[model samples]
Target: MSDIQSYKQTPKYETFSYLPEMNADQVRRQIAYCIAQGWNPAVEHSEKENAFGHYWYMWKLPLFGEQSVDAVLAEIEACHREYPNQMVRFVAYDNYAQSQGMAFVVYRGR
Candidate 1:
């Protein structure tokens, strides 16, 4: 977890707000499900201003070799705790291609 805390009550950065359908529980389970099949995982998010665009896709980090869904979920939860009102996401990457993977927001707001 980060020692620094953000009490801004909202994402000071850009983020997507239309993907609550992909909540934390779902994302965590989905990643676990995929990794059980031998896929990898990573995470990322956007600033507040970029949130709420239904058709927009947020930026993300590269697919790391880290396949621990628990750790990723922990990171996601920590991110939400640090930025309670911000947006956060998780990604599942398989051995398909470098730029091919699944991405979705896992946290909407506090």
Candidate 2:
């Protein structure tokens, strides 16, 4: 067996894990897409060590029927400020699909 092939890689967290960390504009665009789809926006946070865990603490209730991307971005910033040492994620819930349509880490823990 090849050692390189046998090496266990570290597990990555949610969406966009394989890609470079998103910049502010990219995050805003994603939130805008969610809003455009009429999905609800929600924020969640967790300790960096537990980011891969099944659950995270929701920042607040999901923002339903919110149209402005700025509002969602503001909420993300607020969560980041409140939990600077923890990972913060932005999630979009699709009511029609009955599940999360999109989710990604907005802020990595220090």
Candidate 3:
């Protein structure tokens, strides 16, 4: 039997925001581009409202060993350039030790 308690899984990368103008096709295309660039999509969530009349899409990606923030940022920037209609933002989380292993959060706005 597998020891569930002995398995320690790392947290997945995540990004969130309220993007009302982004349509399903646009979001999916951007995600596809990111995946083509070697980024794996972990999860996505969205909601629609008559009041705001906008749709939101949250996405997550998996991170491997140590990665350079600049490299990640550059990749995101390239994505933005490739898709001018999409507004993308990135944030890095500091690990508990604050020594290394930072996390990245990417937000794509319409």
Candidate 4:
């Protein structure tokens, strides 16, 4: 039988959770996708231990209509710089659906 008790698994967040950590280029691609879909992008961060919690600190207001990919990337970079010790996440808010459309960790902090 497998020793379930001895096996330790890392926590997985939203999109790309099963894949390797995404690079800046990959992140940019995701942001571009969000913008292409006409969804708003938002930045958020949380302490590593609290990453699974229901709430995280929003980096700023969500970027409304027709945001540039570079602008979204800049906000992500700023949040990472300010919260180097915390986990940073990028998300897309769907205005039509009036809810979060997608989310994934952009940076992981130890």
Question: How many Å off is the CA of 49 in candidate 1?
Answer: 2.0
Alpha-carbon lDDT, every model = 0.59, 0.87, 0.37, 0.85
Greater lDDT among 1 and 2 belongs to 2
lDDT (tens digit, per residue) of candidate 2 on 62-97: 998999999888998999999999999999999999
Model 2 clash pairs are none
* Runs with alpha carbons beyond 4 Å of true place in candidate 3: 1-61, 91-110
lDDT score at residue 44, model 3, on the 0-100 scale: 25
lDDT of 3 by residue, 41-110 (tens): 3322222122122332333453333234444445565655654454343333234443322212343334
Give candidate 4 misplaced runs (Cα > 4 Å). Answer: 1-8
Candidate 4 TM-score, true structure as reference = 0.88
Judging by lDDT, tell me the better candidate of 1 and 3: 1
**Count of steric clashes across candidates, in order:** 8, 0, 0, 0
Per-model C-alpha RMSD: 9.9, 4.5, 16.2, 4.3
Rank ordering of all candidates by lDDT, starting from the highest: 2, 4, 1, 3
TM agreement with the true structure for every prediction:
0.58, 0.89, 0.29, 0.88
Better-scoring candidate (lDDT), 3 or 4: 4
**What is residue 108's positional error in candidate 4, in angstroms?**
0.7
